[model samples]
Target: MEALDTPVLDNHLHLDPRYGRGIDAVDDFRRLGGTHLLVVNKPSWHLDVEASEGGDFRAVFEETITTVEEASEALPGRAWPVLGVHPGLVSRLVDERDFSPAEARDLMQAGLDVAAEYVRAGDALALKSGRPHYDVPDAVWEASNDVMRHAFSLGAELDCAVQLHTEASDDLTAVAAWAEDAGMPRKKVVKHYAGGRLAGPTPSVMSEKDRLETAVERGEPFLMETDFVDDADRPGAVLGPKTVPRRVRWMLDEGWEDAVETAHVETPKDVYGIDTRATLSR
Candidate 1:
């Protein structure tokens, strides 16, 4: 992981401003000469995880969005934001928990309203890019489409990209359908953790890499990202941010660039689907 501090894109980053305002983390990244730090929103369960700290679930999304806006003001152009939605659509997850759609809509609307402030400034819409995980229902798949369609409409209106998360599952297909349904601009979608699969050895699933290549060949705006993290004391650390790029870099160097635009981008603009003109400027 020595190369980690080398200023990678650090896609799928969760910054709990509630944790050090990420000043130390940014310093650590910059110390390694890192270029960008895309601060993706974190799941409600992820806040203060190592310390059992979490903000109000209802406010987590809005708070994070506002935080990204502030980071943009602070960094001017370095803190790229990512609007990735993981944990299988917050509404679907909480619905099973007895939260009504009306309640969820309130949270979503509030979050989106706050999100719009930054999004209008040009943030990429980061989606989980996954199928159903952890017993997520099929309805969640439709739920994902609903989220993507709505997000795609907003992203397109804002001239941003819809960063969808997908694996071997048909998640990408769902997104494509959503885009078509919304008549959103289609490009190579950003594929996070290109070959990284957290599901653990499911031979039946399609690898993230293959799907990305497909997206690229199809003339989609499929970008590859290194969503690596350093979790020392965990064997999975080997697979986190360190290794994701090694393989990605190899293929990228070996003619993959023609297939799609690959970059180590981190900033509110890049994360939420903006053109990221500055972040990708090599």
Candidate 2:
């Protein structure tokens, strides 16, 4: 793989325990010129069973933080955590865990509280919370939005960034409006796994050049991501972990270096305050 002259940062990925790919994944990214990555903990398929059985969600949060810490120690400043209660988990709680609406709200609030604490302590970078896997029931969708609003409010209070995982075609205008209503800046919101059609003022992360060109043409700040699921069963589920570096190298080769620089370096710093230069040097 050809490395870019400048380093890149992947704003969203899953390096969870169940996935089984650990430091080796990190090393592969680094070798491809990936300077930093944000490890987002999306509640796995099995979390519903555990949470329903009275398993503490805090342990999951702690485990994610620990994994990120270990990765950072192994590859200094290269791994960071973005903790939150995935919105899909809310429906799972209701259907699988037999949680009432009130109970689900309570658990979601508690999870956000823990995530906020870590952000305040500088142990995490951002909160990754939003609707996942479209086609949810209307009630579940509304409830998830309510949870997301609460998360945005907490993020505002804590001055932490938020990464939203929603349908690629969903209107971000509403999302940006919600963020503004929650007293959070639109710039602090990132639309995870984004594509060409943008809906609002918030930034987005995408991988393909054509879509990236569309985002750049709109003059909106954006980042890049692989959204790597790390599932052996779903090889390159979204894109491989090293996809960003290779795409960035392609962009640089195609005379989009300035755009790539802004997306990979400046936009991440603006959104998450990650100083890649300083971080990599350390």
Candidate 3:
């Protein structure tokens, strides 16, 4: 595929230090024509049983901010941070780490509070939080949902966008309803790692064209993402960071430039309040 002439941002990706390949991954993505990325803090980097019990995430939050800063200095204009506690981690803390419901809630809330501070300080572009896997225990699922609701509330209060990492088969209508209850505008909700199966009023960063077409029919805004995990063991577990840009190049080759531009350019700027041209020129 030909290189894209227009800038493209991968809306969700993990480039934390624990990954070990963070910098290399960012470089690879940039070399492949990706212009910008929203670097999310991995759950393991923050949530722990002890921290959960105490409702403290000061250390983890500081590390996450440092990671974002390092990535920005390395790639400049191409890296931004998305902060929040992951629902999956909350479930893990309860189920595997033996954290109580109250402890888990405290941990989740603390993480959201810190995330709010980062967004308010203009250090983070959005909040990343959502429900865990579908097969988790009902109690654990509920706890995760509670944390997610809290995240939505915080995002609304801060006027920041939220990137949701939910189950593949989950109904987004329910999620959107939760966002509405939290006073978060549907437009500020983004379904991360979305494909062709789900549909809802909120925008999504998706990979499949069929899903993209379905979303467009509903007149909701959307973007595209590779969800690159940057894991050597899972090499391209979701898709390479370059996948979105390569797809854009192919779409351009097919004379679908307008549609491609809408997803890769227009929708991202509208939703995230980021200007790719402005970001890259900095």
Local distance difference test scores for all models? 0.44, 0.76, 0.72
* C-alpha TM-score for every candidate: 0.59, 0.90, 0.87
CA lDDT of 200 in candidate 3? 54
Q: Write the per-residue lDDT of candidate 1 for residues 120-187, one digit (tens) a residue.
A: 65543443333344555455555544554555566556665555555444334445555655655444
**TM-score of candidate 1 relative to the true fold:** 0.59
lDDT per residue (tens digit) for residues 75-146 in model 3? 635678888777777666777778886677777877788778879998788988888756776777777888
C-alpha RMSD of candidate 3: 2.8
Candidate 2 runs further than 4 Å off: 1-3, 44-49, 52-55, 74-77
- As a whole number from 0 to 100, the lDDT of residue 50 in candidate 1 is 19
Off by over 4 Å in 1: 1-8, 17-23, 31-33, 48-77, 84-96, 100-110, 122-131, 196-222, 228-282
Clashing pairs in 3: none
Ten contiguous residues with the weakest lDDT in model 1: 198-207
What is residue 187's positional error in candidate 2, in angstroms? Answer: 0.7
Cα lDDT of model 2 by residue, 114-203, tens digit = 788888898888887877566867777777887788889988898878888787764688888888888888888888888745666355
Clashes of each: 32, 0, 0
Q: Candidate 1 overall Cα lDDT vs. reference?
A: 0.44
